[model samples]
Target: MVTGTLDRKQERIIAGIPPVSDFSGIYFYTINNKSNHELVMLLDSIIGLNDSVLSDWLNITPRTYRNYKQNTDVVLKGNVKEHIVLLLSLYKHGVEVFGNTADFEHWLTEKNRLLDNEAPYSFLTTVSGIKFIDNRLTALEYGENV
Candidate 1:
């Protein structure tokens, strides 16, 4: 992690954002690595599904997929199912994976990018949440082609 007050010289992204917290790199890349054409496209292209697809899928026109790109907490509010689906779809196809919010936020801070995702103001990561999503959740149920 960068230190000493944002010197603003070496402005480069430090790491891959798993595209999510639920799945680790192993699981995330495994799904996307398959020979699935749709999955491949999702990986190479930065934001896979645009706002329209998410809104259409979740039946919410006012919302945006860009909003969904950050922490899962806020996105889940409008429709937990949709938020989770987007994440699973991304993880299953995306090449990288972030372990948790700390890792994601660290990247944002280092890159000096706008941190806009609406994570709950007081959200805290927990062991159970990680375990549940990683080991217990059914991948296919959430659009993970794995």
Candidate 2:
């Protein structure tokens, strides 16, 4: 089973989805209630990723990100929404493992031998890559050396 330190609301948000073993299942939980402003806040507040990285992950331009932040009514769709859910889920696991946001963010950007000297953040752009990172994080949680 997928384990983490997520609160009841976060757990409820992801309850419909399958466990993290099927990492792609995370995309099935759409962000229906949240506006763009909420998502942006979550990204900044939880994951601590910057605007440039978020823009790249969402496949949106920097200007669009600013516009979304400026317009509270704007809602995200398509890849942007999917990426946000994925990141939020990952952030939960990361916090559970690392114990704090700063440590998780550092681990994300730091090169790891298990990942062939690549930072975990490099995998955030694609579904398959996110799955691989999730698998690695699961392994780490279970005391697997790699």
Candidate 3:
């Protein structure tokens, strides 16, 4: 295991909630390192998915999710960390495509007729789902009416 402390800058970058447009470099780096539970909390604050739902997305029981939150330095498993990063990236893309975070967040929760009245939020449980959403965002970005 790679054991070390994250300097304030590194923590700031990782905990920046929805990452900015040039976040791919940092995203790639974070994928290989373990993340603190605070990342999860920050993500929750922005997405506002309750722990129960978020825990399910993380593929862990609610109890384990709570346990993770208790430890500030807890290192999330690789898959969990990757899922978080991808979610962040998806949100970042959403914000960019929609021109604001609020609209993007609204779009995530609101059911879309194009998607057969299913809220895009329902697909956030897996990495493929995140990618699928990202692709949809790309379509919107190009004015393809997705």
Question: Best-fitting candidate, measured by lDDT?
Answer: 3
Q: lDDT per residue, candidate 2, 1-146, as tens digits? A: 12354455545554443444554465455534454566565565555667888777667887888787777787777667767767677766776777777887788899989789899888888866766777778888999864
Q: State the C-alpha lDDT per candidate.
A: 0.34, 0.68, 0.69
TM for every model, in the order presented, reads: 0.23, 0.77, 0.73
Q: For candidate 1, what is the lDDT?
A: 0.34
Name the regions of candidate 2 deviating beyond 4 angstroms.
1-28, 31-34
Relative to the true structure, candidate 2 reaches a TM of 0.77
lDDT of 1 by residue, 13-95 (tens): 11232434434652554443322332222322333334564344344552443454433343234233323334334333322
Better of 1 and 3 by lDDT: 3
Count residue pairs with overlapping backbones in model 1: 3
TM-score order, best first, reads 2, 3, 1
- Kindly provide the TM-score of model 3 when superposed on the true structure, using C-alpha atoms: 0.73
All candidates: CA RMSD (Å): 17.4, 4.2, 6.6
Better of 2 and 3 by lDDT: 3
Tell me the tens digit of each residue's lDDT in model 3 across 18-123.
4333346546656644556756665665555578877877789988888877878888877787777777667667866877667887888899888889889778
